[model samples]
Target: MDLNRVVIVGASLAGLRAAETLRNEGFDGEVVVVGAEPHRPYDRPPLSKKLLAGEWEPDRIHLRQPDTFDDLDVEWRFGVAGAGLDPSAGILHLTNGTDITYDGCIIATGAACRRLPEQSRYSHVHEVRTLDDAMRLRAEIADGGRHVVVIGAGFIGLEVAATARQLGNDVTVLEGAPAPLIRGLGEEMGAAIGAMHEARGVTLRCGVQVDRLHDDGVLLAGEDGAEGELIEADIVVVGIGVVPATAWLGDSGLQLRDGVVCDETLNALDVDGSVVPGVYAAGDVLRWPNPLFAEEMRVEHWTNAAEQGAAAAKNLLAAAGRGAGAPEAYAPVPFFWSDQFDIRIQFLGRASADDAVEVVLGSTQPNEDGTVKFLALYRTGDRVHGALGVNAPRWVMKMRGQLMEQASWHDALAHAATLA
Candidate 1:
């Protein structure tokens, strides 16, 4: 296989990292990156925290320095989206009416924010997916007197609520589930998060159905048909979830479920289960089977994206006969962190709803200073599945290492007990 040219779609964190990896691995081919967003690759995590809080400027969120591309000798096609893909011909069509032929391609298009149903009519409705989104929402609450209504109790929703509260706004969070983040962190941990928000003056309206979003506010009704209340607010931010940015590949003949389906090697697969040669995917847009967990999953986190990007690039090189050995599988222990009020929540590894959960250290109960710290471990029988820590960064970091090593449930529990 000859590697003359390489095209990377979606100039995101994953795409940027992939490009860097290709060059570092001695691939002197023509590397081109295509991005829909005009801005250079930036960090998305701070968009909700420091960026929204006005603590960091937009330029500060960039993943690399401004002259990074020049140093890497890469060409960037910014502000133009990928329209279609002709894999058989090794050609990529862009929205700007330009097409490029490539010997290898990396699909790192990422994901887009899931918008609320019928939210277009309301001008105050917002989402925090991009830098523009954070800027707009930050401007709305700049005066700090607005009544902010955040729909959903997930990480994004809760982070917005916390930031709004910090700005002196009245915040109310609405969640359809009985507790916040029930699906992600389970009921016990979700309730703990809900209580933390309530203690910080944010209203928690859980298990309620939102009827509609009006210009004035949100109309909500109880799930059991009980009469509901109209919560008035000056702004509403929806943080429900996100969908993969795979719409452009609708006719690309690639497999798609919730994301671009791939094998363990991060190679995009066709509908017939055959590999789409020279094409690969990473980041939130990728759905691959994780060998460590023995389950197929799509991890939408920074750590996974960075690790997968490098892995995908190496595999691309392997396919081109540049790699030293066979392509390696991407198997990473997923990790994520969130900042709400004064608490820093971090989780390591994966866990299902049926996994057994136990609080191993500290307590979720607020102390006299309103600070909460704790460590909880999740297990299935004798195998450790996951671990969560609030305001315990050191312990969480240690636990992350243990999770990476696949520590047994009994040993992890004993180690956590010692920490407690």
Candidate 2:
């Protein structure tokens, strides 16, 4: 297939970067970016942090320079989403009653925030996924007298809780798990995080279930009782999680599990495990095998999306026989960071709940300033699997390189002992 045009669906970080990479890789073919949101690509991390706190304006979160789109030489189809894909015919149907034929297509639609079932019926219910969500949340919580309730204690929810507290509002964090962030960071670290919020005056209800959402508040249930307590809330923020935005591809013949299933090369695969030529996926919408972990995972970090977008672009060129040689497999040592209150939490590599966590430096003990600083190594058997650093950037930076080198558990522990 002669490469004449490449259409990138989803005009966010991944899509924009992929378009820039294609042009850089010497693919002068026509490029098009389609987005459901009317705005151009903007940074998302701030939506939960600075934007939610009202520390930064909406215009400050843009992913690119003001003149970037004008120079990209690509057609922009904003406010219209990709409704369907006819992969066999190499055509993409748009929500605006238009179709685009392409030699290559990159799926970067990303993910949407998961909302509670009762959200639609309540005007005060919100989820922080887009800029508008943050703007509304920030405005709603600006009044210090409002009682803000945050459902879920994940990064986003915790960030919102912190910001709401900063705005002088009474905040309560509801987590069904035994501890905050237990599903992601395990019990020890999750408890440490819970302590941080507690010190900041954010009430945490852990190991409790929210039975239902009322017009004014939520009904809670403890371990033994079905209707336990009612917490009054003027504003409710749901940060349960997100699901991949792949509903449009239901009949597109591509494998869709949690995300768009791709092979090691980031090329979309069919139901038979065969490559679906001319179709690739990147960002949070992509599930590709990482050689480093020997497992297929979809990463939602900002860094992962940038790296995968560029990798997908190169692979797209190579797949079309328009590049120098075979493309490299998309394998990256995953890393992500979160800032809550005064602590900066950084993580590198992967670690499951069963992995052994050994704190090598500082302490998870709360300080006078409601901060906990620590550096921990996560390992299973003799291999170092992951590392977590709280308020310890230098340690995380060094361990990241060590993780990429696949440092042995013994050597990593020895090095970590020095930091202790």
Return the top candidate by lDDT. Answer: 1
lDDT measured at residue 334 in model 1 versus the true structure, 0 to 100: 90
What TM-score, to 2 decimals, does candidate 1 have? 0.97
Q: Global CA lDDT of candidate 1, please?
A: 0.90
Stretches of candidate 2 exceeding 4 Å from the true structure? 222-225, 367-370, 418-420
lDDT of 2 by residue, 1-420 (tens): 688999999998999899999988899899999999989899999888888888899889998876888888989899999999988999999998989999999999999988776578988888999888889888888768889999999888898898899889999999988999776688888888888889889999887788777788887874565576888999889989899999999999999999999999999998888899999999999998999878779989899999888889999999889987987798788998888878798899987888899889888986676567889889977888889999999887788767887889998988777665
Off by over 4 Å in 1: 222-228
lDDT of each residue in 52-93, candidate 1, tens digit only = 999899989989897776899999989999999988899999
10 residues in a row with least lDDT, candidate 2: 219-228
Residue 363 in model 1: lDDT:
87
